[model samples]
Target: MIIAVIGAGYVGLITALCLAKIGKSVICFDMQTDKIESLKNGIAPFLEPGLPELLQEATNSGKVKFTSNINDLKDSSIAFVCVGTPNDPKTGSSDLSYLYSAIESLENVLSQSSTIVIKSTVPIGTGEDIYKKYPKKLSFASCPEFLREGSAIYDFMNPERIIIGTRNDQDKSRIIDIFGYFKDKAEFVHTNVTTAEMIKYAANSFLAMKVGFINEMARLCDSFDANIKDVSLGIGLDSRIGKAFLNPGPGFGGSCFPKDVKALSTTAQNHAKELPIINNILVSNQMHKEYLADFIVKIAQKYNQNNIGILGVTFKANTDDMRDSASLTILPMLKSKGLNAIIYDPAYTNSKPKELDNFNFVNNLQGVLDSTKIIVVLTEWSEFKGLNFNSDAIIIDFRNIYCISDMQKQNIKYYNLGRLNEGAN
Candidate 1:
């Protein structure tokens, strides 16, 4: 089967490479000539574990090709739209301009029997709207992707479920055949386009709510002199509430959770409905970010520590994505209060965020640790564990990366969310 993936971003590149690995000939198209050229040379633009090697292998096999021209999509029987739907700054709704442009470009070269799959996360009814506007010969489906950034390759190869959203039986059959490689490995869900779109939004929003709920619980645990680690384990052991986003941290911030939660709330408001839980999740998450900043400042003041060290600036470990990361908000808040921070991340040693252009970033963890009196573990990177610590340095662990007893045994001042005595000097 010949497949075309639009937009050479994380989703498009991974999808094209994985499809080629599964024996399908794929041509990936992106408007960015530089990104296309980089891919052509077997170099990935972003940091994803196991992606560069996979790209090299696919390129060597000659099963996948990268191009900047829309004309390259002519031979593809199916084209997957993987463009981004970033949140609108003014309205907090998903900006579909990129998706629309991709559709327009695909429409120009679409064959009579070609299927256009919407793999991007979009609002409900978007698929129907596209199908209505496009020619009858072209088919549409809403097959939203659920791959995480760091483990995208593994997720793509071992998806839990494959959703095919189409109205026509012929379209469903065609999509099934396209994904026949995963027929036995994953569950195939056939549904209408709107429901499939709703599933993506609802799934992400629910996970965001879970993170928010646990963070709120962590605050209560702090007040009542309880430990969230124990609380999570006790509740997780129950069959009804399985543990998965229960671990407390600064807050949940990433490419999908924050934007999708806001988009879902906006969608509900557009329909003249109320979503109190979703609204509270957003507010609570914002407050949590501020709370962490204030907590760090309070600790620094208590110990008379002026210099701060930050570990892990990326949203999560194993990926270099800094979109909506907690460090983005927390570090700026601290800087505004005249506190200085030296930051370090394994992936972002060379790159500086535009927002944090003036901030200090060290190339190694030891440099950050040496320059600051207070060490803040912002992102949960595995490399931060078992590191040598200065006895005088105060450690504020947002991700609970270390045990409270261990920190106490070393006689180091350590603080973590949801643990009692964290605020005590």
Candidate 2:
């Protein structure tokens, strides 16, 4: 099959590479010529584990290609619109200008009728709207991606469920054949386009709510002299609320959850419906970002040291994507209150942040740990577990990366979310 994925961002990049790996000829198109050139030379613009290797293999095998021209989709069997739907700067609603442009451009370039698949996380009824406006009678499906950043390739190869949102049986059969590369390893879910779009929002919003719920509980645990880790474990064991996304962190921020949740709320409001609880989850997550800064500030004052160190800066480990990262928000809050900070992320080298001036990016973890009086474990990178700590240094573990058994023997004051300490909660 000849598949054309529009937009070489994370979603489009992964989709193209994965499809190529599965013996399909894929052309990943992007707006930037530089990005296309980079991919042609087997260099990924962003950091994702296993993507560069797969890109090299696919490019060598002549199964995957990158292009800046939409005309390349002329002979394609499927054109997946994987472009980003960023939120408007003024309004929180989804900005569909980029999405509509891709659709119109592909419409002009398409030589024959083809099925259009939406891999982007868009609002409900967007597929129907596009179907109405399409120049030709092109079949459409809303097959949203549920792949996480660090584990996109693995998730793609082993998906939990493959959803095909088309009411027509013929359309569903075509979509199923496209997905048959996975064989019986992936389950199929048949639904309407609007319902499929809503599934993406509902799934992400529910995960966001789970994180917010735990963070709120952590706050109360701090006051009542309770350990939130134990509370989370006890609750998670109920079988109804499985233990995942329950661990408290600074907040949930990446390419998907934050934007999708807000977009969902905005979509609901447009229909004269209310999602007060989901709205609260989004607002509460912002507050959680501040908690990391507050914890670092208090630790700095306690140790009487103005220097602070950060372990990881990415939104999550294994991926070097920094969009909407909690560290971006927390680091500035610490620096504003008179604290010198140095950061070290395994996936990142020495790139100075444009907005933050008082921050220093170091090459090695030891370089960051040696100079600062307190170390903040921002993202739970696996290598951070090997850092040597000073007795006087304060440790603020946001992601609960440390081994609980070893923490008991350490002389440094360790403060973690959901884990109650000895003194006054």
Q: Using TM-score, give the best candidate's number.
A: 1
lDDT of 2 by residue, 243-293 (tens): 987888888888788888888888878889887997788789888888667
Q: In candidate 1, where is summed lDDT lowest over 10 consecutive residues? A: 416-425
Clashes of each: 0, 0
TM-score of each: 0.98, 0.95
lDDT of each: 0.89, 0.84
Candidate 2 differs from the real structure by a C-alpha RMSD in angstroms, to one decimal, of 1.8
lDDT, candidate 1, 290-339, per-residue tens: 98899888998898887899998888889888888888889989999889
Q: In model 1, what lDDT does residue 401 have?
A: 88
Which structure among the candidates has the greatest lDDT?
Answer: 1
